[model samples]
Target: MSDSNTPDPNTSGAPVPPRPPLPDSGATGHPAPSTPGQAESGTPQPGNGWFAHAPQTAQHPQAAQHPQTAGHHAAGASFSAQPTDTHASRTTDAKVGSGKIVAVLVAAAIVGAVSGLGGAAIGNDMFAANGTSVVSQGSTTVTVNDPDTVNQTTGIAAKTLPSVVTISATSSSGGGTGSGVVLSSDGYVVTNTHVVTLDGASSDVALRVTTSDGKVYDATVVGTDPIYDLAVIKLTDATGLTPITFADSSKLNVGDTTVAVGAPLGLSNTVTTGIVSALNRSIQIASSAVPDSGEQQQDQGQNGESPFQFDFGQGQQGGSSSSGTISIAVIQTDAAINPGNSGGALVDDKGDLIGINVAIATAGGGSSSSSEAGSIGVGFSIPANIVKRVTDEIIADGSATHGLLGAMVGNAADAQDSDIAGALISDVTSGGAAAQAGLKSGDVVTEFDGVPVRDATDLTAQVRALAAGAKASLVYVRDGKTLSADVTLGELTE
Candidate 1:
């Protein structure tokens, strides 16, 4: 089996401090300015700068007050009458002010050397000081330098990237790949359900999760919801997992920094950066909006009569409710998303997940059998706020249900042409709340609790917002007259 460990190391960051320089010996046979202090003898001293005095030696007040040294005292030796070169030269140099100048110059040189060393050390370039050895083990490394490298943001990307996994699923007919964020140490992973189609593989679906080290593991689908299109999966023997951090998606706005990390086009861990293109964009899935007429009808030319009859049951029938548009609200982003990128994370600048990439608008029309269903700029993600609701329901009950009104309604445009206004109910469930409230299939629901409903979509949205078993007053248009009735909503069952 391949090692599941991640071997990538943290990138180089801040610098290190410089090392202290080696002390040099002076020609006069004296320790090179041990510290910044005055000489021990009671003779007048020449050099009087900050660095001129040896800090290690005791200060002589009389010598400091005087401007010159009368004689030279070597280690346990005193110079006599006929002076040696050291004593004669010292006397002449001290008298000419050369002794103090030379001492000050040497002190400055030492300080400069120390400063340069410190700079190189802090610069984080271990090679700058001298080519030192680097010790590394399992994604961690240490480099020896003259000083040390202090990092504030190191280890973050390395720690988080490994936890980010690439997911691929295969079925009998086709396969898909995406990315997922590990949500638990025991192997719970969150990804897009569209990445792994149901395909009757509820228990037999094969999944492969690849870590940063190129190691692959067999994974299993935990549960998924087609409504939200989010799925959770697990792998065996998983531990020490790093879960992704979540950000408040409601607080995000257009122009915010959006960074997508996913396996775009099967390229694992591919990262792309962009901004939120548009918020609350309405997108429609053709399959969801237009149902197939199970029975194919012969071409009837431009009579505009669709073979299938759409029954609007507590939901909006396909018609331009307003502004000639028909689709559910969605979040639009410009971040690069591909067919394989579904279920990957759309994160903020701080690395917090904001959304899950779901679908991209196709180019022209029809589906391509090629492997490259990549983003052409426009991409849509299921809003986290909505996904949260769907996920909660799916986890608790294994399915999501909408509020049911028990009335069969038709599209506003078709009803308008038929001289009907509001929701034209074609049928009502027997013994249902509407039937018990003295309502019939021909009644047109025009309002609810005095709130005017322009079309079925607005009514469904408002009614679905209410919890099941809630009482609502319904107003309908019957034979050019307005009427009202109180009815309790029913639980929607799949």
Candidate 2:
């Protein structure tokens, strides 16, 4: 189910407010471009935002933003819940044959042949007709092999099903169902933060996890990183449980076999198979946040705020002005991940967990209404590498930290217009990592560590992949000369 606040794609009856000009950077002399695809004049140009050459007056419908909340509830009811039909019946017929007549006939023939020898044989035929007869019986045995063979889909499912669990979240307002992956034998399970939070609020929500073996246990939220759309939960009294093996997501390639195991539409232990469609995909989804104590305010940024100012196209519609939402990097897959599949396992051919199945794109678009939809071959999963890093920190410290570059970067089109092929730095935070590395506002970041920074989004994703406080080598263009710098990353703070 998509987020209730997501906008519908078919209707264009309402006019969107005109976007404001990009914020001016003081002392830097460079203003951020308005749209990633066009210049400051708002003219249509070839770029990444939406329409690659749409007229300034032309208003294109926004792409539907699906939140991938599989267990979304509506007004105290489950959106994916349905009445289950369990009554089934079968009929069989049996056939019987009479052997008495056959036995009597055989005795009569023997007696007739023996009658020539003795009259006593004739009396035996009459006795056989009135006496009990011998019956013949046959038996046959069949052997069936187990279907869960190694290297097959069934094998993957069998190996991973024990670690994949169904999650149920309820509140006084409503309840819903999703899925989770066991991260530890002592009850640590990883899932989307939205799965347990109520309407993006962490308070007043109750969570429970049901294992594949039909065991249910109450769960407590250990910690959640809303920016990553990941949360860690602990199952009460859980021990000796099976945990999934995490594969190196960095080793995954396109066309590698992927198997998704989850409970779609409340169906437990369901498995779907496909191949890795793409990687390093950035998607925007709504996130819930609780206000600080005694804080009373409204109209926080619609797209929310990120420590590393990473902007991806237009902000998705459907979030309230006060509600916080953020974009996250994900692994794209053609696997049939659907509503109720959130927090499930996306495993590789060897049954090792590569990603956590999260949101799925749908054809119907997203709305604030109470309708639910299925996947359209475009599903996104949180890479297992990030999952491991974030969950480990949560398990130890009750919160997770992300690496930040402390610079406001421009989009790809801005770089192209500047005749550069890297991320353009429009502003650098005072005393931040970028400033400490001698990076000025006009400098264009070309490379970080060893990976090329193609655009602002690309740079943000790479920084997030690393741990805070790690050292990184950066190459940038200042004036007409290129320079390199070694700097320590900064930690993101809320």
Candidate 3:
């Protein structure tokens, strides 16, 4: 695989995608000065605005083929330094009256450089004891002391980099590289299921993981949950590894600082910084499937349950009936998520994992064969709460079980248009959780597990967030009467 930093000749001709709109609340400072042929020092420069660096390749392995849909696979983009005009130069003259001016200029230069001004100004008084003409047209280099302040991006990267890893998977069909996060010291890693499996097949896939220290180890699949787009893999021989900490994603708020770490476009250990752009976004992408004589066939779990479903608006079904699609409630961020960033960590300011960087919204609309563009700042990640719940189930058993309400719920938009305040039950499965709980058709589910159910999508997201067999209380309105009942959630079946 090619390194992500390397430029690609193929993509050189492609048009640069438009950037997503950024919030106007942040400080609008001047850009930092450019230092050609120099390496980044990870210092937070004043006016060092963020931008999405296009990946070398547009071929994201998980990118969706359908452009008309909202959920499309996207890769992570690297964040690189851009030129700015924040740095300024000062000149000192060898005059009797210029001593105070020179001292003030030097002090200002030092302060500016330390505060992310990107450069420093020096006077000739320090170099020469006697009054000598030091001011010249030639350029002079100034050195400044490193600031004591800590950069949040650098700090988060330092704390979590060891726990992140690069995952390379090869199968008879094809091979690609992605990222993963360590879950246990003995080598249990969590990644997107698509990272380890082929497009259409699960078996016969070979997996390997490369840690931050440059050690490579063979790995095997422990379990996979395509419905949630997550998987667990174990290294053949791993020990004493640092595992990442999970944060409470439910408490996240918009504008909270976020850092995304992954191997974008095969460039390992890349980090990008941004804020939580939004929350509770529902996205649906095409499910992983193999082509059968030009027809797509959805992959089923061991229990024969289809792992994906489409959420067509107004409760109308869309897409191929035989094929399935995965719908998820995601955390949105402006962090540069590109191809190869799939299954990577989206951490908060404290270095705790809050989400898994998954798909990016591209200007090209993405295709099944290849990504048409890189990140546009609209990146989505699976919330850590869902990750924690689903991964726990996968680790406990070889498979994951989702909680099911066993009812056909009306679309939230439809309910709103019809003046309904909750999830309207269009039908209830016989002997299912709803039926057993005394819920009947035409009942509107007002609340689930103490959380308000604004619509069908809200209810679906809440149910998926729960574990199978968990006890929950449901409040619904039946025949214009409000009622409440305690129900034991049933495991979703094929």
Top-scoring candidate (lDDT): 3
Residues 157-209 of candidate 3: C-alpha lDDT, one tens digit per residue: 55567667777766555556667877888888887765655433346668778
For model 1, the superposed segments whose C-alpha errors exceed 4 Å read 1-163, 198-203, 213-215, 286-329, 367-373, 393-491
Query: How would you encode candidate 1's per-residue C-alpha lDDT over 3-108 as one tens digit per residue?
Result: 1222111223334233345455554565544221222321111211000000000000111111011000000000011111221121112111111111111111
Q: Comparing candidate 1 with candidate 3, which one achieves the higher lDDT?
A: 3
Which residue pairs clash in candidate 2?
A: 4-368, 5-318, 70-340, 200-288
Prediction-by-prediction clash tally: 17, 4, 10
For each candidate, the alpha-carbon lDDT, in order, equals 0.43, 0.55, 0.55
Off by over 4 Å in 2: 1-151, 290-322, 364-372, 479-483
lDDT of 2 by residue, 183-282 (tens): 7778888876656664353355687778877789999988876656667888999997767777787776665567787777676777788777776665
